[model samples]
Structure formats: structure tokens, C-alpha cells
Target: MPAHDPQATPADELSQARRLLNRVFGYDDFRHHQGEIISTLLAGGDALVLMPTGGGKSLCYQLPALLREGVGVVVSPLIALMQDQVDALRQLGLRAAFLNSTLDAETVHATEQALLRGELDLLYVAPERLLGERMLSLLERARIALFAIDEAHCVSQWGHDFRREYQQLSVLHQRFPAVPRIALTATADQRTRQEIIDQLQLQEAAVFVNSFDRPNIRYTISDAPNPRERLWRFLEQEHPRDAGIVYCLSRKKVESVAEWLTARGREALPYHAGLSDGLRRHHQQRFLREEGLIVVATIAFGMGIDKPDVRFVAHLNLPKSLEAYYQETGRAGRDGLPADAWLAYGLQDVITLRQMTQDTDATEDFKRSAHQKLEAMLGLCELTSCRRQALLAYFGETLEAPCGNCDNCLQPPQTWDATEAARKALSCVYRSGQRFGVNYVIELLTGKDDERIRRNGHHRLSTFGIGRELNAVEWRVLFRQLLAQGYLDTDLEGHGTLRLTARARLLLRGEIELHLRRLRRPERGARERRGRTVLALGEAEQALFEALRSRRRALAEAQGVPPYIIFHDSTLAEMAQRRPTSLGEMAGIPGIGETKLNRFGKAFIEVIREHPG
Candidate 1:
């Protein structure tokens, strides 16, 4: 793998890549469209790759960076992300370094010397650093292999993680027109894809649209009355002693949740913009380097997280859009084990999001576009079919059937006529002059004679007290589904006032059928009652797995790195199940690259021998 060479055929380059994969990365074959994507890059062609999170996107660029002639200049987004990537590369015996503000000038100069001397295979530079005049000059002096623009969705204004600096990355294409460039992102819809291409100037790049389905992740959404207790249920029932992320919408939520969990004896940390830089860094570092730790964070966390064994991603509120939800939950189950993407959303989440979108300082067109995006996410919560199928469908990919993993597909939601109920609710709104929000209609239907209802004489309406057959909680569910199903609309100008849309008139006229799902009661005792005691392996083998995990943790602690960095839980599970005795057998294990085998093989093998199952 040098700076320049004669043309290599596809078969030749692939053979070379397979050899490198086994020798360096420890995997035997490429996952999904990885082989084709890497081959395209090695042949000096550009690509726009849309692979799901944990779909081995890193290898698409990392392997090519090694096979190409010059050092691969990767324009990454964050220092933490670069550090984690470089750490993984170094563990694989690859020469990888990232230049960011964290490095002292002397260290930066030394890394520059390494690059100029042709001693590095992959160089990770933040986009800001790469666009600087001095860094551009440094690249001019060194042999270039190709460029990889990671987290490419950051370049899209409509993307959840939009960065002003990333918008300027088109300079890479302009400056290095001949070199092949690959832009990679975990989550991007059709519009975002086009935005990425136009923003990055990769018009001619071969597009690779891998399926967005993460089948191993169990998707669950509950409109729970007590979201905190519901989240506790998920954490206790599903993921104990596993690394996971809990995403909140605001900094205050992050802090309170973190504190609440901490008081309850969970190793939880708060991460948001409100925290000092040092405090945020410390919390992030702890979350990475430790296990069984949950980080209650705003959207500020999880961009650069490379931890592979995050077993669950829990959300206390609804995400802004489907793409944001997809990206956030993707941080879980990266090791390809069974993971859960659990959410607790309600009508308030919808109302809050709608109001937020309408109150944005952007123009009406921008606000309208934002509202549409928010609606897509709300639709997911209202889905009665398969969560995964609906999610994939949003990205223009169709799942042939309901994924057995999501909650809806497993225990299909029960739908009732709800036509009479929907009409009653709509009549309540219409008879009340349709000037109130969802809460008011729900209150009137539930026969709650509050002061406002009594003062406004709203309780005397024909629709009022007509819905007493349903409780307040149940009525709220019907109203939410009505709004989501387009029988009702929110007046953003009226501050979330509920109004009838055209579809509601049909229902009122008895010319339309309406059905709504009954809200499922949240589990109150899963976490405390069953804390993940079951194992994929048998009793004897399960003991060996624990021992192996203990040993990995010891080594990771000694090295001051995340335990997954040493050996992912999936890999350890395989090792425990297989009961490899010798180094040769260990080498055959998945995730055992040559460098890791050389460094940690004998120790793990010895442990297996000492605790033979």
C-alpha cells in the first residue's frame, strides 16, 4: 500500500483487502455493502454511502486508507470521535493520528513530521483543522491517498447535527478533484442525501444505499403515564451492567435525570451544553471507560461514540424527527447483539415540538419544513403496524414484512372503532368553538368540571360528558391519535389550540371510519424483578463468559481504555461459547485481528483453559 501504483483489477484489490481485513481488523469478511464500497474507493472512484449505524461504516474508509498509496486524510467532526477512532486503529497496529485543538503545538508538529515522512496510513483531522491554511499547506507537501468525509449528514442544514463548519467541506472536492472522496453518514433520508451531495460537491460519486433496518434492535414506544418509572423498567429488565445512552431534549432534563438516577445508585452522568467543558469531558470519559454506566444527556452526546456494546438507548421524550431518532438509537447494539430502542412519548411531546418549531426564528417556509419533519417522528409513535418497517419506509426502503423485534409486531396494538369517540371529541372542539388545545377537549370529554370548563360553560355542550365511558388517560389517547391521523390539527398561532382538519368533517358526518390504538400500560417492575440474568450460553459456559468479561475488564482498566475496545461483549460471548483452547483456534474467532491476537490472545486463551466449560 504505497503512494502511487499501477492499476489493480477488482479481483486483485479485493484479494488484497480480504488479506488486510483478517490481518488487521480481525474479521473474516466484509459486512453488507462494505466490500463494494471499499472496492470503489480503492479503484479511485468516489462514493456517497448511507449505511445504518453499527453497519461497519468505519472499515469502508479505514481499509481503503491502508490499501491506497498516500496517507488517508479523514475530515472528522469531533476530538472525542477522532481519539476513539485513532485508538481503535492503533490497537490494530495501524499508524493513525488525529490533529485537533487538544494536542499541544509540539505534538502537532511531530504528527506533521510523521505525515510528511510517510509513516502514517490514516490521518484524522477535524474539518476545521483540515480547512485551515497551515493544514492545507501540510497536506500539499505530503503524498495523498484519498479523502473521507465522515458524519457527512452534518453538512445538511436539515440534518439534526448541522454544523456551520461542516458546510464548508466542499473545499476538499475543489482542492483534491482527482483524489477519490467518500462521504459517509449513519442516517440520511432522500432529501438529506441530495443535500449532502450538493453541499459536498460529490455529484458523480457512486451512491450506496444500504438498508436502514437494524433487525437486532427491539424497537419499543409507549405513551406511558410515568415515563421515569417506565425508563427504570427498561433499564432493569433489559440492560444491567451494559453501556447505554438516555437522550433528553433539554439540559435541565439531563441534569435532573442524571441526579435522580445517581441518587438511586445507578452510575449516571449528565452531559449537555450547560455543563463546563471540563465537567462534560470528565463525564464523557467516565461513560466511555466504564461499564453499566448510563449517560443522561441532551443531543450533545453520542456523535463520536465508538463504544460497540451499548445494549439499549432509552428516550424520555420524542426526538425531533425520524432521522434524529434513528441516529440516536443507533448508538446501541453496535456489537450486533440483541438491543432495545425504547421510547416513552405522549401528546405533550407532540405539542411541545410543534410549538417549538412554530416559535423558531426562521422564516415560515423553514418553519413549515421543520414542522413536516417533526410530524414524521410523531407518526412513528402512532404506528399500529411495525416500528422498524415504518422507520425504514421513511428512508425510502421497504421492509417486506413486520420485523418481529419491535413491540408493535410482537404484541400488535389493539384497535377499536373509535369513530363515535372521535366524533364526540371533534364535536367537543367544534361546539366549544375549536379555540382550545388537546387538554381542554380531553378534560371536557372526561367530564372534568374544572373552573375553566365551568366558567366557559363548556361542560354544558352536547359533546361534553359524552365520553365518560373512557377515562381521562384513555380520552387523551384518542385525541392524540385523532390529531396524528389528520382528523385534527394544532393551531400553532393559537399556541397549540386543537382545530378540526378536513378529515374531521367526514368523521363528524358519519361518512368515515376511525380507529385508534389503546395505550399499553407501562411495565412497573421489569428492571427490579429481572435484571438480565439469562445468558446465551449454558450454565457452565455462562460462568466462563463472566470470567472472560472480568478478565477483559481487568486488562481494559490497566490500559485505561473502554472494555469494549479490548474485546466486545459479542466477541467474548463467541469465545466463551466456542471454548477455544489454543492460539490457532483463537485466531479463528471473530474480532480477533492479528494485532489484538498478538497482544491479548494468550491471556484470554489461558483463561479459557483455566475455566474449561
Candidate 2:
């Protein structure tokens, strides 16, 4: 650990931070608000940081802990990820250890003794264990530097990933009044942000709210009827042989998708709460240590995962809220590379989610909040305007113009006036008793004179054949839009029966206009487009990049750590392009810190030298 000077000026502290930043983390300068956040902690002040996932939130506390007097204690919610966190820090040559259930009694004792003797620079602890009496007493006896509360939004009851243990974290403030506390999270709306501040008792902390927009992620929402096929097309086109996550709404769907993808020749795994702990841990370890593997999971996975090179995140069903969506999608592109956030949803998703929300045994207010969040997510999917703009605005941020990277911006959708169509659809739902699901409703509208339709109703009804101007697919799209726009609602206890909301009266009376996005089939050759290139490497550089990656994989396997912990893909790309010949030149690269330059620099340099460029 670097020694801190008590008499150092603020500028001097900052300069030392910058030097350590290069020597330890291998970055040239501080990104966005990192320097200010670090300076606050160095001056013994509390902080509340809300930055995006890849926005370097860990550095804000980790760097300060290295420069401070004693060990920095990090309170994390995910116990499974603590080992990786400690391993990454240790790879940087920092004295870091974690105390969790995975550690045996002897290991725990050694780690605790290390803290007491002031021999550790940083220590990671789960919130549940940190709040225990033994750990609290142990901390009181040690010289503590600061406390970092990660995934701080979990403290909010209204947040998407709320953990009951987080609310108890306020004890940190009461116990260690002088130790500067920093609470950090990747996703937090205005409501969640306030709750975190309130629950964690960080009212006097310096709040640093960075922009919530992840511009590198291209958002795409498809309502195509064949979602599985669409997902395959997406994978085949954009992320072939890339590591990603596929989110489903149920454990059954998670397992099926994993099996289906595996049959289709992709290495996919299933992860959910239903699975045993040992199985979950095995899948997670394989995902971290291997390459191009996909994990099909529910919301149970991916809270504090530090894998940096995930290429995409796909959702087969609608998430409960935009907060959940943002957090899940932010998992991609953690290395500042281009990634995709894809969704394939339909009216069924809306119905299933609404029913799930209503079926929950929570208070009415909670149910209403969940419904509003679901509505917002639906609006995003049915939106004909810029998706990024509306998504940002939901989180209280504004994008001045359309982000050209999103589906809507790239290929603008055409809208048609569906006023009369909506009126006819609603009338069919009413005239047919409103006791049927979407398929039944659509069948009646498209003039399907099947036995069920004939037995239930007469073919002589006015709405029976009135919607012939639109095909079955078009009618499905219109019905989905109607439900999403609140002109129609589904029965809570029924089998997805359609019901008219009070807002539908005006449309029925022709008092207002209704315009909806025109449904169009995806282009046949769309999959031919190349995926986003992380670096503009020439042919020779590309070959050299592969060689460096092979070397990284070998080293990572030998040391039993993830390859990115050794050096991220971006770093290898830089090394391939620069072709550094000596230690000094290697140190000049972006991700080559002093520790790494001395540790693996020679091996990589030899690879660069021996490559046939």
C-alpha cells in the first residue's frame, strides 16, 4: 500500500492518486467524477456515488483505500462475487482479502488477524456478515480507513433488487462516525436514490450523480411473434461466440432456453434460485473462467459480477420495471466496448406480468407501483419515437436528440392512423362478452368462422367481419398497442380476458385519434451485418491480438482466475496494435500498471516479438 502524508495538500493528494492510478490500475487519468469522489474520501468525508456499471465506481473507494492510513472495508451484497473482487485487487498487488461463508475457520482467523495487525489494504465483506456482532467488534478494534457500501440501491424497498439485509447497513454510520462512508450503485431512479440516502443514513454525504445513459448500448425491442427464432437470429448475427446473458421470467423458461440453445450448438447454462447452490456456483465459475458461454437465467443472477467483456444482454420477456431493465442491460459493455440490449416481447408478456403483479401478496400501494413500472416498460416497447430518449427521461435524464444507434433511430418505424381499427377491436371484445384472451379476440376480429366462434357467437355480428382490412398479425399488433396504451386492460383472475378501461370510451366514441406503429417483418439479410468492432485492428494486429489472448487464457488458467483479471480484451487489443518491445514501452500502454508490467510484461512482449507480423 502507498503511504499517505498527513500534511499533504489537497492537490498533493490528488497528484499522488493520479500516480497510484497509473502504477496500480494502469489508467492515465480519472474518469468523470472519480477524482472528486476520491478527494472527498481522502479528506475524511462521506460520499454517495451513482454511476453506471462500467463507469468505474470501484476505483472511487479502492484507490482512496490504498492511499489512506488503514484498511478499506467494502460492504457488498453478493457473497459469491467477493472472491473475484478480492482476486482482482490482489492481482493488482494490493493486500486484499474477503471474509465470507466460503472461507474456512482457519482462513477467517488469519484474515481477521491481518486486519487487526494493520497488514491489509482492503477487505470485502457481505452486508449480513458485516452487521454481525463479532465483525462489528473486530472492526472496532482495528484501524479502519473507510466503508464502501456497494449496490447501495438494494437498501431501497422500492428498488428492483432490494435486499432486506441492506436496510440494516445504517449501523455503519452509527458505529463508525469518523470513518468516511461511500455508497455506490449502478441503477437508481429518483425514488430509489432518496431511499438509499435515507436508509443508509448518508444525509451529510457528498452526492455525486453521474449521467445514467449508457450510450454504448444499442437498444432494440421487437414484438415479433416468433421470439425464439428472433433470439437465434440476434445471436447468429451480432454475438456469435460471445459471452452474454439471456434473461427469462421463469426458471422453467431458463432451463428450456439453455437446453434449446445448447441443442442449437451454443454453450448455454441455466441459473435460478430453484437450482442448488453448488450447481449455481459451478455455472457461475464456468461463465467467469471460460469464453463465449451464455447463461440463461432469471433475475437471480448478476448483481455484482465483475466480468468485463460481456457482449450483450437479451430479454425473452418483459422485466418488471425500467430500473430492472437498466440494471440488467448495464451488465453488458462493462469494458467500455459496444454491446447490445435486445428484447423480444408481445401482448402475452404484458398479461403475464400484470397477472404476476396482481397475484403477489403485497400491499395495494406496492401493487400499484409495480403496475406503473410495468406500464412504463410497455410504453418503451410500443414507442415509435427515440427509445433512448424516453428511457433516459424515465430516470430524470434527457437526451437532446435521438441516439442514432437504437433501432428506432436506425430504421424509423412508420405509424398508421388506427382509430377505426382500435374502435372495432374494442367493440369485438365487448360484443363477444370480453371473456376471451388475445388469440380468441383476434380470431373473432379476423372473421374466423371456426366452430368455437360460431358456438360462442353468431357470425352475423357487425364486428365479426369488419376488421378484414387488417390481417391477423396486424390485428395482434394493434391489440398489443391498445393494451399497452391503456385503452384496454386484462382481467386479473380470468384467463387473460380482455376488458376495456375507462380511457377506451373516448376512442370508442371517435372523440380522439389513435396512431400506432406499423408492424413490419425484420429484413431477411439483416443478420449479415458485422458485429461492433472493439478496436480497429489491421489484419496483422488482429492475428497478434489472438496470440495475446491465447497467452492470457493460459496464464489465467494456471493462476485459477478470470482472464480479464489478468488483462482485459481491450488491453490486449492495445498491446496488439502498439507491439511494445520493452518494459518501458509496455508501461506506456493504457492497462499496463507497474505491477502488471513487471509480472506478465515479458511473456506478452515475447509473444509480440515472435509473432509473424
Candidate 3:
């Protein structure tokens, strides 16, 4: 078999890839851009793919690696992700292995020997390991199919998850000039895309940009007070018994939130850079293997987690940039089911993020870029229109109509002309000597007779009692909106004191009319659990699904792998609904490839046969 099939027509090559897909992965059709990407690589051409999470980006390279003569080298970032991918491929009975720090010397040498003998269909390596001289030498002795750079956006300085090691991956191109290279990521704006191309030296690679819209995800952002309670309400209402991730901006918050949730009768774990590596791994493993587990974490937790049933991703604080927000939120609903991206941010989140960005030791240009990204994120949170439209537009995609899925679309927020309110708010900030935080300023505005106000002489100010019409909650909402809209800025040096911006000058001078979202009380009544029933199975089917899950869990525990490695929930749902009692019938299911049919088909068939319904 030739490493490069130069004479095969595009039609023939695609036909072969499709056959391999069905036989190995048990999928009948190609998703959005998988076929085009696979064909690009199969024809000995480089590709730069930008497909959304769960859009079948893996198949683009995985299928081609199997069809080609030599092993496909995949550059991955996370050890857990590589392990999961390899385990999944092995479950399908494919020749897959990973070389990472987790493996001992004996296993690493055996994996290298297998590669030299052309025994691996796919090999996943970290960028740091792949750039090493020893690994480069080993690859030179083996037949090469192609190179895949997963999470390719990490090479860009502008991206949220930038890794300096990824920038050195151009060495793959420099060394293996003949072997095709494919760089792929789920999130990257136009600037990051160009940077990836330049840094990875893939300017000539075919660029395939799929739609960044994850319609299954319903985005909701709230500035409600008592965010801990808001998060509890959200979890109780929607994801009471589902696996999810809750993100915090600080490691301390991660630990505290996890402890709080655990005390509240929910099993939550903490994950951050501060935790010991063993503990982090243990928490991550528990989150993956168990159902209805929530992992409260900082940005360190999720980057290439392959768990498919994450029903929600909640953020208790503001993320640094829109790219980070989009990337983090994209982790939910990777299985293409209805999921949620919920956020509970406050004025203090804004102040803290601004201070952190300013205090960073990065270059001024990078700081400016970070500020711009932060502003975009604030804009998305403050959007009264379709959030999906604005989010897609940030990635240079267009949604002509409202999605009707996001919170803004489902429960349209009413906007009020706040020209007078804005002028009074700005005046209050200025009249307070620009030295007090939101609480003090709001107290002064609402005519609260406090000793601190008297000592500060704010009681005699003209703006002290002007905001008496609105209550404290309403005023806080207005002030948060003011900060989000850039009409008010936080004094980092003054302990988050509110100060007016140039933008606020126009509003106070009567040059512009300001309209803001009216602060509505959090919805009252019995909350309905929406989008939780992913399978939507009948009672009998639900019982059978549980039985199937039990069997999968047993098998996974025996093998020391996550249950999804054996079979995803969707695959089991199909089995439960179809109740395929025979091995032949089970093979007709979507995820049961030839290898899996031969491996575990009879066990699942026995379960289906024993099911009462």
C-alpha cells in the first residue's frame, strides 16, 4: 500500500473514506465539512479546519489515517483527552496509542517499536514531545501518513488558550515537507486564524471554516445578585441530575464553590492548578466516570475533555474574553443535544477582570487586545437581541433571524429609556468624590442616612436623593449596566470606586439618549426542568436504558476506562429504543461498527433480550 494515493480520484477516495467510516466508526454519512477535510488530507494536501465541537472533526483525520498506508501523527495538548481518544479508538478495535507522560519507559518504547513496524493506525503526541529530537528521529524511520495539530489555535498569541509550545510546531512542516499537515480547532476568530496559519507555517493549507453556531446550546447571561443562590436555583431547576461544569475565575472560588455544592447535597469536585496533580486527576476522573457530577473549576479544567453528555456549563464569574467564553461554553452539548450555557456575573466580576487585565505583565499591545475582547464579551452579556446572532457574528458568521433558543429570544427583556436615570447615576458617581464603590454610591443616591455618608459629606450633595425613585436592587442593576456599557469605569486603585468615562459625559450632557434593560425580579413559580431529557425515552425504554448503563459501567470499571469509551449514551439510547435482541440487528445501530459488534454486541444483545419490555 502506498502512503500517498496520488492516482485515486476524489470520488473514489471519498467512497473509500465513507466505507472506512461505516466499518470502523459506524457512521453512515459525513457531517458538515468532514468529507471535504478528509479528502483534502487524503489527496496529500494540508488543511486548516475550523469545525465546532462535536461536528466530527476527529473523523476528518482519523478516517484518512486508517485509509492511508502509514500511521497518522496527531498533536494533542491534554493527556486526558489523548487517553480518552485512544481508549475510544481501541474500543472500536482500531490500532491507536498515545505517547505522553503517563506512560512508563517500557510502554513508551513498545509504542515506538509498534510505530516503526507500521502497527499503529493513529498515534497521538503532545506538541512538546513531538518537537523533541528523539521523537523526530523515530518518526523519520517510520512511514508517515499525515500530521494533525488538534487545538491549533493554541499557537496564536491572540487565542484564549495559547500555548507557547504549539508555536514551535512549524518544525513538523520544516522536517516532513512531503507529509501533509492539518491544523484544527473548535474556536478561533479571524485574527487567531491568521496567526495560526502564520505561526504553524500552513499558509498554503486548505482552510475549511464551518459554522460556529451550536444551536443545541441555549445561552443565558444574568447579573442577578446573590449569584450563589442563582446558581443553585439554575441547577435545581434545570440540571438537577445531570453532569455539568461550573467555572469560576479564581481557584479559591473553585474550591469554595465545590465545597458549598457538596454541602448542599450535590456531589461537586474542585479542579484547578493549585490542586495536587493526583487530586486533580482524581476529580477529573470522577467527573467523567460518574453521572450527575459537577466539577467546579477555573479555566484549567476543560480543554479537550471528550465527555459528550455535559448538559450545562455555568460560569459564576466573567471570563476574560469572548473567545474564552465561546470556547468554554462550547464544551456543553457536544453530543448535539439540547444543553445550556448559563452565566451569573455581577459588577464586581467586571471590576475584578479589568483589574487583572491591567495588572498583567503582558505587552501593551496584548493588553489592548485583551481589553477589546473583554468589551466584546460584555457586549454579548448586555445584548437585548438574539445572543446566538451576536455570538456567531463575532466569529464572522451571520444568522439572518433570531434563534429563539437563547434567553434573550425566549424571554425578551424590556428596555426602558434611561436617559434621566443614566444622568443621575453618573452625577452620583461624580458627586461621591469618585472614591466609593457601588454600595456606598448607591446608598448616597438612594438617600440612605449612614454615618459613612455623613463623614464623607456625601449627604449634602445635590445627587444624593435624586435616585430615590428606584430601589437599591434596581439601582445596582442600572450601575452594572452602566459599567458593562462603558458609561462607568471602576477605579482599580480605589478599591473598585465608580468613575465616569468619556462615554458617560455625552449621556450626562444630554447629547445621547441611554436605554437599558429594566431590572426584573427573578422569575417566580415552580421551575420546569427543560432540555434535561436528552433521550426522552418511554418508561420502559428508560428502564432498559438504565439497565444498559449498568452493564456499560461494569464493563468500563473492569477496563479502568470511562463508561463512554464502551458506548456513548446516545448509542445505548438507540439500543434501548430499538431493543435489538440479535447481534445482526445490533450491528445495524449507528455507533456499533464491525469491530464493536464483534466485541460487545452479544453482551448488549443479552441485556436487550432479558429486558422485560
Candidate 4:
């Protein structure tokens, strides 16, 4: 086994890639743009891949690695991720092993020995360990196939998860210039993708950009009187007794929400960086293994989980970027099941996310990047168009129309001309020495001359009583929209005092137009429980599902593992969707077992022809 050897001919490599694709991954087809990436890698070229989260990225590298007749050294970022991927690959009868800090020295030595003996198909290593001199030497001694960087966005300084260790991965190209390299990321905007190419020195690398759209997850945003009550209502209505994640912006909030869900008799757990390592691992493991469990956490969870049945993703606060939101929500519906992406947001979420970014010690360029992303997220939150369209547009993609599944597309929001409202608000900020907070300015404009208002002499201003037409809540909403639209700025040092930006000045002088979306109450009709549609199944799958259902009913009659345990309605529906043409495909369905398949697979296939599509 050596690092450098004569490369295979292009025709041979292409035939090898195609053969491995059908033999290993069990796919008779290649997704859009997959063949081009495969050809680039097989031709001994580097590539940067920007695909959506569930866009089958693993196969792009897995096929190339398996075809090259040597070990593929994959640089993974997390121990848990490496372990999970290795376990799945081994289950598929491919030889895969991982070396990380979690293993003892003896295990590490044994794994290195296996690599040198050319006994493994793919080996996962963390960037921290892979960049070491000893590790490089060991790799040099082995038959190197291809070097793959998973989650390559971490190398970019502008990405959410910037790791200093990832910067060291550039040495791979310098050390093995002949070996093909592929950097794959699920979530990277234009800037981050460019940074990855520049930082990884993939100057000659080909780039593949896929469409950033997930049409299955329905997006919904709500303004609640009390967010907890709304969250409970949402959980009860849409995703009861199903696995989901609730994301908050703080650890305390995570704990509080988890406890609150528990008090409400939900099987909920909390995870955060503040928790002990043992407890975090325990909770995470349980959440993965069990059903009907909810894990409330900050953004510290759901990186490399491959669970196929997550039903929903709820956000108690706004995420900082559309990319972050897209990646987080993608955790749901990985199995292509219909799921919900719900959010309960207010002005405070925007303020908190912005303050967090502003206080970080990153460079000014990083800060500006963060701000632009935040603004994009805010735009998504407040947009009057289809939420799905707005989200896809941010990623330089387009949609035909409103998805008709989101809150906005279901119930059109009302809009009001706020030109006069904006003028009054901006005039009040200017008259109050640009130092008063929104609350005080609203009070003065609505003609409440309280002690502070009189002390500040805001009552004497001409704009003081001009805004009496709007109520307190309406006024607050106006200012929130103003803040989000960049017409106003909050002085961070003075308790977020309202100050006018250039946009506000333009509005004050009637040089700019202003329109605001009035928050619409969730329609009572929208709350109705829509019945789930079972897929159109062929004769065999339908019979199989019915037989499985009959067995499930019998089991529920006996020891009682619930009909869902035998097979969820979703699993039955998917049995109809895929029409599993073979026994292996049947096993790939979520809850089907060999016993079940052996007993009922033929019957299901027979009934599949009669099943509705």
C-alpha cells in the first residue's frame, strides 16, 4: 500500500464508478448533477459540492472510494458522527472503521494496523488527528484512494461552525497532490462556498451547486399572546406523540421548556453545552433509540443524526440565518415523510440574535456577514410572499408559487400602508434626543405624558399626540417592523434606545414609502386536523401492509406494543410509496423486519397493484 501509484484510465474509472453505484448503494439512478461530480473525482480532480442536507452526499464519495481499490480517508468532525457512519457502512457489509479521541491508545494502534494491511474500505478520522505528522506518515504508507472532507463549510471563517482545526486540512492537497479530493457540505451560501474553495486551495477544483429547496416540510410562523401556550397547542394539534426538536437561544430557556413539557406530561429531555458530558451522551442516546421523545436544546444538537422519523422542528426563537434554519429544519422529513417546520417568534428573538452576533469577537468582515444573514432571516420571518419562495430565493433558487402548505399560503396575511405611522415614529425618535427606548417613544406619540415623558420634555414635541390612532400593541408592532426593516437602530449601550438611521430620516421627510404586514391570527379553519393520505400502493405492498396491520392488531390485542410499533401509519404509507420491489428494499423501510418480510412480503407485493398511488 502506497500513497502514490499510476492512476487508472478515465474509461476504466467511469465503468468502476457505475458498477459500484449499483452494487453497493442499491440505486439504479443518479440524482441531478451527481454524474458530473463523480466524473470529476474519478478523473483525479478536486471538487466542492454544495448540495442540500438530504441530497445523498455520502454516495458521491462512497462510490468513488469503493471503486478506487484502496482505503478512502474521510475527515469527519465529530466522534459520534464517525461512529454512526461506520456502523451503518459495516451493516451494509462494507469494511469501515473510525479512529478518534474516544478510543484508547490500543484500539487506535489496532485500527492503524488494519489500515496498513489494506483491510478497510473507508476510514474516518477527525481533522485534529488527521493533520498530525504521525497520522500523515501512516496514510502515506497506505493505498490512498481519495480524501473526502465532510462538512467542509466548517473550514470557512464565515460559516456557523468555524473550527480552527479544519484550517489544517489544506495540507492534504500539498502532501498528496495526485489523489482526488472532494469537499462536501450540506449548507453553504455563495460566500461560504467560495471561502471553502479558497481556504482548501481547491483552485482547480470543479464545483457542483444543487437546488436548495425542501418542499415536503411545511413552514409556519405565529405571533402568540404567550408562546408556551401556542407551542403546546401546536404540539397537540400537529405532532402529538411524535419525535421532534424544540430550539431555543439560551440554555436556561432549553431547561425551562423541557421541564414545562414534562409538567404537561410530555416525554421531553433537555440538552445544552452546560450539561455534563455523560448526561448529554445518555440523553442523546435515549432520544435516538426511543419513540415519542422530545429533546429541547439550543443549537447544540442534531448535527449527524440519521434518524428517519423526526416529525417536526419547532423554533421558539428565530435562527440567525436562512442556511441555519434550512439545515435545522431538514432534520425533519429525512425519510421524505410529511413534516412541519413551526416557529413562534417576536421582536425579542431578532434583538437577541443580533446582539449575540454584535458581541462576538470575530473580525468586522465576519460581523457584517453575520448581520447580512440575520437580515435575510428576518426578511423571511416578515415576508408577505410565500415563505418557501422567499427561503429558496435567498439561496439563489426559485419556486413556481406559494407552496400552499405554509401559513402564509394557507391564510393570506393583511398589509397596511404605514407611511404616516413611520413618519410619526421617526419624528418622535428625533424629538426625544434619539435616546429614548421604543416604549417611551410610543407612549409620548400616543399622548401618554407620564413622569419620564414629561421629564424628557417629549410631551412638548409636535409629534407627541399625532400617533394616538394606534394602540399600544400596534405601536410596538410598528416599531418592531421598523427595527427589522433597518429604519431604526437600537443603541446597545443605553438599554437599546431607539435611534434613527438613514432610512428613518427618509421616511420622516416623506422621501421613502413604508408598508407593513399586519399579523394575522391563525384561522380556526387552519387548525382543523387534515386527514393523512396513505400512498398509492400496488397490489403486493397493500396486501403486505394489511397483513402487517392485521398482525399489529393481534399483537395490540395480546402484549400490546401499539399498532404503530409494528408499523406506523407513516411506515405503511411509505411501504405504499416505494413499492419495495425486493426483500432488501423492504428491510430499508423503517419498521419492517426479516420476520415480518419473510411472513408477509409476498402478500404485500401482490396487493401493491391495487394500492392507490
Model 3, residue 216: displacement in angstroms? 1.1
What's the CA error at residue 103 for candidate 3, in Å? 1.7
lDDT of 1 at 540: 85
Local distance difference test, each candidate: 0.85, 0.91, 0.89, 0.78
Consecutive 10-residue window with the lowest summed lDDT within model 2: 526-535
Highest lDDT model number: 2
Question: How high is each candidate's TM-score?
Answer: 0.96, 0.98, 0.97, 0.87
* Ranking of predictions according to TM-score: 2, 3, 1, 4
Best of the candidates, TM-score: 2
Tens-place lDDT per residue, model 3, 1-613, is 2244668799988988888788888889898989998988888899999999888888989888888779999999998678778989888888899999989999999999999999999999988899899999999999989999999989988778989999999999999999999999999998999999999999899999999999999999887789999899888888888999999988999989999999999999999999998899889989888888999999998998889889999999999988899889988988887899999998878888877777777999998999899999989988999999999999999999999999899999989998998889889888777777889888888999899889878889999888889999888888888988999988657388788899988888899998888764578874777633667888899889999999999989999888888888889999998999888788789888989889888888889889968
CA-only RMSD, every prediction = 2.0, 1.2, 1.6, 5.1
Q: Residue-wise lDDT of candidate 2 within 78-187, one digit each (tens)?
A: 88888888898889998999999989999999999999999999999998899999999999999998999999999987878889999999998999999999999988
Error of 1 at 511 (Å): 2.3
Q: Considering lDDT, which of the candidate structures 2 and 3 is the better prediction for this target?
A: 2
Q: How would you encode candidate 1's per-residue C-alpha lDDT over 1-613 as one tens digit per residue? A: 4333467788888878988898887889988899999899988899999998889988898888888888988888877667767877787888999999989999999999999999999999988888898988889889888899989999988888999888888887787788889999999988889999898888899999998888888899988588898787677667756678999999999999989988877889999999898888888888887878899999999985888878889999889989899999999888778788899887777777877888777888778778888888888898899988899999999899788989998888888888888888899999999899877888888788699999998878887788889887887777778766778778867478988989888989999787778888764434442224434677788789989999999998897777888888888988989999888899988899988998999989989999966
What lDDT tens digits, residue by residue, belong to model 4 across residues 385-440? Answer: 89999888887788987789888898788899999988888888887888877778
For the record, the alpha-carbon RMSD of candidate 2 to the native fold, in angstroms, is 1.2
Clash pairs detected, candidate 1:
2-69, 3-69, 26-593, 236-527, 237-527
In model 3, state the lDDT of residue 357.
Answer: 72
**Clashes (N, CA, C under 3 Å) per candidate:** 5, 0, 0, 19
